[model samples]
Target: MVTLGQLTKKVEFLEKRVKQIMKMLQMVPIVAPWEWES
Candidate 1:
C-alpha cells in the first residue's frame, strides 16, 4: 500500500535522476556526433 506521499517522493527522485541522465546523454552527442555522420 503505497501512500500518495511515498509515490510523490519516488517520482521526484526518478525525475531528478532522469534529468541527470539527460545531461550526461547530451555529452555523448556533443562529443561524437560526427562518429555517426558517415
Candidate 2:
C-alpha cells in the first residue's frame, strides 16, 4: 500500500540516480575522447 507522496518520493529518487548516471556517462566520453575521435 504505497501512498501517493511515497510514490512521488521514490520517483524523485530514481530521477536523481538517473541524472547522476548520466553525468557519469558524460564524463567517460570526455575522459576518453579518443574513442569518438575516429
Candidate 3:
C-alpha cells in the first residue's frame, strides 16, 4: 500500500537526481561521430 505522499517524494528525488546528471553531462565535451571516423 503505497501512499500518495511517499510516491510524490520519490518522484521529486528522482527529478533532482536527473537534473544533477544533466548538469554533469553538460560540463563534458561531446565529440561528433564524424570526427571519430576520420
Candidate 4:
C-alpha cells in the first residue's frame, strides 16, 4: 500500500521536473506554429 507521505513526495518531484522543463522551453524560440502540418 502506498502511504500519503510517499504520494506527496512523488507529486513534489513531478512538479519540480515540470517547472524545469517549462524553464527550458521558455528559452527556445518559436519559429513556426504550423510547420509540422506539411
Candidate 5:
C-alpha cells in the first residue's frame, strides 16, 4: 500500500532529478536535426 507522504516524496525526488537533467542538457551543445541539414 503506497501512502500519500511516500508518493509526495517520490514526486519531489523525480522533480529534482529532472531539474538536474535539464541543467546538464543546457551545459551540452546539442544540435537540432534541422541545423544538421543546414
Candidate 6:
C-alpha cells in the first residue's frame, strides 16, 4: 500500500521532471503540441 509520504514524494519528483522538460523545450522553441493538434 502506498503511504501519504510516498505519494507526496512521487508527485514532487514528477513536478521536477516536468520543469526540466519545459526548460528543454523552451531552449528548442518548437510550436506548442496542443496548437499543432488543433
lDDT of each: 0.90, 0.90, 0.95, 0.92, 0.98, 0.94
Q: Across residues 1-38, which tens digit of lDDT does each residue of candidate 2 receive?
A: 99999999999999999999999988884655577666
Arranged by lDDT, best first: 5, 3, 6, 4, 1, 2
What candidate 5 gets wrong by more than 4 Å, as runs, is: 34-38
Compare the candidates by TM-score and give the number of the best one: 5
The better-scoring model by lDDT among 2 and 6 is 6
lDDT of 1 at 35: 78
Quote the positional error of residue 10 for candidate 2 in Å: 0.2
Listed per model in order, the count of residue pairs whose N, CA or C atoms clash below 3 Å is 0, 0, 0, 0, 0, 0
- Deviation (Å) of 1 in candidate 4: 1.2
Model 6 worst lDDT run, 10 consecutive residues: 29-38
For residues 1-38, what per-residue lDDT tens digits would candidate 1 score against the true structure? 99999999999999999999999988875656677777
Q: What is the Å distance of residue 35 in model 5 from its true position?
A: 4.2
Mark the regions of model 1 whose C-alpha exceeds 4 Å error after superposition.
Answer: 30-38
Where is model 4 poorest over a 10-residue stretch in terms of lDDT?
A: 29-38
Give the per-residue lDDT digits (tens) of candidate 6, residues 1-38.
Answer: 99999999999999999999999988996987788978
Let me know the TM-score candidate 1 reaches against the reference structure. 0.73
Please provide, for model 5 over 1-38, each residue's C-alpha lDDT reduced to its tens digit, 9 standing for 90 to 100.
99999999999999999999999999999999889988
Question: Per-candidate TM vs. native?
Answer: 0.73, 0.73, 0.76, 0.77, 0.80, 0.76
lDDT of 4 by residue, 2-27 (tens): 99999999999999999999999889
Candidate 3 clash pair list = none
RMSD of 5: 1.3
lDDT of 5 at 28: 96
Pairs clashing within candidate 4: none
Over the full model, what C-alpha lDDT does candidate 4 score relative to the true structure? 0.92
